[model samples]
Target: MSSVRRAVSAPAARLGLVRALVGGYTLVYLARRRKMLRKVVRTDPAMFAPVGPVRALRRPVPAPVADALNDATLVSTALFTLGAGHRLIGPLHSALLSWTLSYRNSWSMIFHTDNALVVHTLVLGASRAADAVSADALLARGPQPAAHPRYHWPLRLMNASTTAVYLLSGVSKVARADGWSWATGDSLRRQVAIDGVRKEVFGSHAAPTAYALYRHKALFTLFAVGSLILELGAPLSLLGRRFGRLWAVSWFGMHWGIRAIMGIKFRYQMSGVAFAAWFDVERLLELARRTR
Candidate 1:
């Protein structure tokens, strides 16, 4: 093959391999880890909060909410992954998922990007290269005039919304700060103190260290410095494709780590959608060509 051919084909090939692995993992994860997923989804108090109902709002559903949430989540996630209710189901569940995450959840520390990941994946997953990637693609460039099987409207909505949100987040930090470097331990500590549930959840995790880091001038200041750098650069992601993708890589690792080490599932159902924020969907096509 010519050099040009190779250049065009590599990404799709890589994408395919990733998809297969992701699919296999999803299969295994569903078959073997369903119980575990159920456990975490229910037991983790921080994962959900009892909000006022459409009418009056009830206390924790008599039966543990996790099992209930799992059943519903399974229904939505299944429809999304199977390409069942592409539009109607995915966005509805996405909204519900976003609403459930509260300031208390560890995942909420990052401006609730998890919601975007989940909704985008549920809808666009069919097109994903990873099992977490799902079979519902949100941004197919082909099959126009009919239903574009490549991408879903919900995913596009998410991409646009995420870009807007990231932009807003960057603007807020920059607007208030002494020019970035504002995230330090003090800020984190203050944030936790204000949010009752966060204080309860994470304060328990690192306990003495949480306080020590909160008080130690050097450590707090150092973390604070790193925090703003990330937040400030976040909006630049809106500038173009490359920036968004690089951000996706970091965000993906960050959330995945939260799940593995912290025992918290941060957007488990939508991790693959992060790729859409940065890379062109066409890249998948190129990878597909190479593998072929």
Candidate 2:
């Protein structure tokens, strides 16, 4: 327990930066998706197979109720981001977002885009993320701890969660029949072609670049091997900050490469939220201020 506490303990300032980044990102993300979420209210209630807390409801919520919940979430999220009443607002925001997203997915297809992010939000809300650089900090009359376990533990947990996702994906590849063949076989090219076909048939266009490379089995084989290595080696981030950044970059490349070739986007990963742990956000903020 002591070791665990030590590992997660972080400076209040660092936690403050994390709170700002994660909270701010979530706010912007919510705003950007307001239209899509609004559609959920208008979606057929017959389609709502309740999940999470909403499962307790015997019936789908009225559109007005849904809209009210959505608005409440946005407001709570803004308060959480601004560091006002974060201890209360943080968890409220996380819960509201989770409920909203789960409700949305329940009404339709399960979208994995926000899974990691939502997990991060819950962890952040439960931690001492608002202890520094926050309204709470300014309002406190007593001296705060220089560092606290609650501050950094959330970041570590978030990092582990994100890494596990990649690691499992890598394990899945090799866990299948002749998984090793992914590297030596034409699995990569075939998958790309299939993705292209699927997209084209669905009224979307496949990446022409992917089609051009489909004939080159050798290059595709290399790509396959690289992807496997990246996913399997995700735990490298647990070793140190430098390793974390390296893994983050490789992961970023993996997401971008797949999108470029398959036209499938992992918005959260591409947005840099998954790799927040590896960055010195305080330093970056200082640099931005100086440059401005």
The clash count for each model shown is 27, 0
lDDT score, candidate 2, position 71: 83
Which parts of model 1 have CA positions greater than 4 angstroms off?
1-49, 52-56, 60-69, 85-88, 91-114, 118-156, 163-223, 250-272
Q: Which candidate leads the pack in lDDT?
A: 2
**All candidates' TM-scores?**
0.48, 0.89
Residue 34 in candidate 2 has what lDDT?
A: 85
Question: Candidate 2: misplaced stretches above 4 Å?
Answer: 1-9, 141-145, 288-292
The whole-model lDDT of each prediction reads 0.45, 0.81
Report how far off residue 107 is in candidate 1 (Å).
Answer: 16
Candidate 2 accuracy as lDDT: 0.81
True-structure lDDT of candidate 1:
0.45
